[model samples]
Target: MKLPILSQEIVITLQQLEGIGNKTILSKIGSIVCSSISTLDDLLSFWGNLKGKKFEAISNDDIKEANRIAKRIISRAVDENVGIITYYDEEYPEILRQCTDEKGKIDVPLILYYRGNLKALQIPGIAVIGTREPTPNGVKAGEYFSGEFAKQGFNIVSGLAVGCDTTGHVGALKVNGVTTAFLANGLDWESIYPKENLELAKRIVANNGLLLSEYPIGQSCGRYGLVARDRLQAGLSKATLVVQTGVTGGTMHAVNATIASKKPLFAVEYRNDVDISHEKVQGNIMLIREKGAIPLRSNGIDSAVAIIRGTDYKQVTVTQPSLFD
Candidate 1:
């Protein structure tokens, strides 16, 4: 019997299967945690044994295919300058490991491929996301809320997409506050979506912030990529704030994911002139009126900060900014 931590190659192999959405990867890695798994080859054989006995081994081709996928993922990460951190790795963020569901199930990710300052993971943070194509009111709300949140010393997290997501990052940066962008594409911090935000991404990293992803390099920003990306946005913080979103779209997806994960949500209130009755604002309102997501206030951010720090508003002390500030 050996320790999983001793077999670096096994940990790497498990990370390769991260986005495969397989129960086998979970069980195989969980098996390696304690008892006696020894060498890298032994860990491989353990997975192989599970496939053979617990699961019928379809063919040698399966193992070959798995290895091939692993190589491809790694190659892309190398090309993009992405750093892959397995759950077993010391660099994996500690806050995420503490998530507990209603049933006490932890929603820990297998690996987190990140780019930019790794130190940002240790800092307290909040997320802001909403409609992809926001209206004027939504845009202002996102920016205003983000700027104020950053002022209060909360590191911002967003999907790095357009509309509410990008606005949040921009607002935080405007105030000389730290902000992190989570991407759905490859780990290469060099590229960014909308190509318009490429410079914005650089500014974020330059400001001592981070750009992170779970996927490999050159991975297309597709449906699954966004879904995987959304989880990081929601789970990386104490609360999620939606400036605007339609009843049936990206904002809705993010809001629902946050709810499932049991994180708090705050939707910006509708403006008086904009048709609050429109479908775009429906989701935000629903979260407030039905699902119990709190409403935004001029002071809502202060409340959010208190919640995140687990301190009363008066008890919350301020900290000095680093070089990024």
Candidate 2:
């Protein structure tokens, strides 16, 4: 499907307005003009109405700064060959558009900067997330599950972090399958986080995969941006799999977002005979025993595939003691 392209003016307007934190004001503006922003008159009319209203509280200085930033970002994107997709564009992932937060509010990005195959978003996807530091066993599990899923025509989606997220992308790539990395920073090569994944990001684009981000060019990753990026990881996927994680960290954030979005969640089940004190697998155990995520056996890739495909597959339940116990 050919994605709908937004006009340069509309893209600039959305990018400028993205810094607004007040949802009420942003929503009001979006409702009035998002659909008609292609018309310069409508955009100007909205800007004209911004004065003396709650939106005006943003200040002209802020607006000017935002516009200036938007122009720079656009110039950088063009020079770097990055693609921009707005919420108003049909190219934006529909799954992401349906994602909601704990409050049942639609949680989605207003603008996305991506490098590589935009068609990757059109495929069925499963997000694989876990701790940054994975055990040897955790690495094996991530590779096994992600590779199996990729072979079944599922696009592996991940944060492109170290450990399990990187393993997930590598596993998919090993099968010459499509994988999309959603970064917490900009899509520019200079902005790629974890520096180690720079080569992997290149391989993704070269192999027809995708690298996506909501941040504009030159913006570095922040604590809140990483937290916010988790939702997009979950939102873009048909389901989210926690290969291995500790109780705390970004993996758990993705877990919460997945559940809040009402998407199916699968966590790898550790061997009963093995030591459960392993920190990497602790989050997986907690998710299954406490949060009701389905326990997926390492060899049960078929069942995992079925869950994402919405097929009726045999369900496996784990009765392990809760970590909190």
TM-score of candidate 2 to 2 decimals: 0.87
Candidate 1 residue lDDT tens string, 1-325: 2224523334445544434342455565564455444344555565565534433433445545556667677777777666777665677777666543323355566667777788888877788998778877777777888898888888899988888888999989889888989888765644456577888888888887888876567766777777666767777777888887776676665566677776677777764545377677888788878977766755456666665566543443324221110
- Model 1 misses residue 211 by how many Å? 1.6
Off by over 4 Å in 2: 1-8, 14-19, 22-26, 39-42, 50-52, 56-68, 102-104, 272-275, 312-325
TM-scores for the candidates: 0.80, 0.87
**Could you tell me the TM-score of candidate 1?**
0.80
Superposed by TM-score, candidate 1 places the C-alpha of residue 166 at a distance from the truth, in angstroms, of 0.6
lDDT against the true structure, each candidate? 0.69, 0.78
Least accurate 10 contiguous residues by lDDT in model 1? 316-325
Best by lDDT: 2
Pairs of colliding residues, candidate 1: 1-36, 2-36
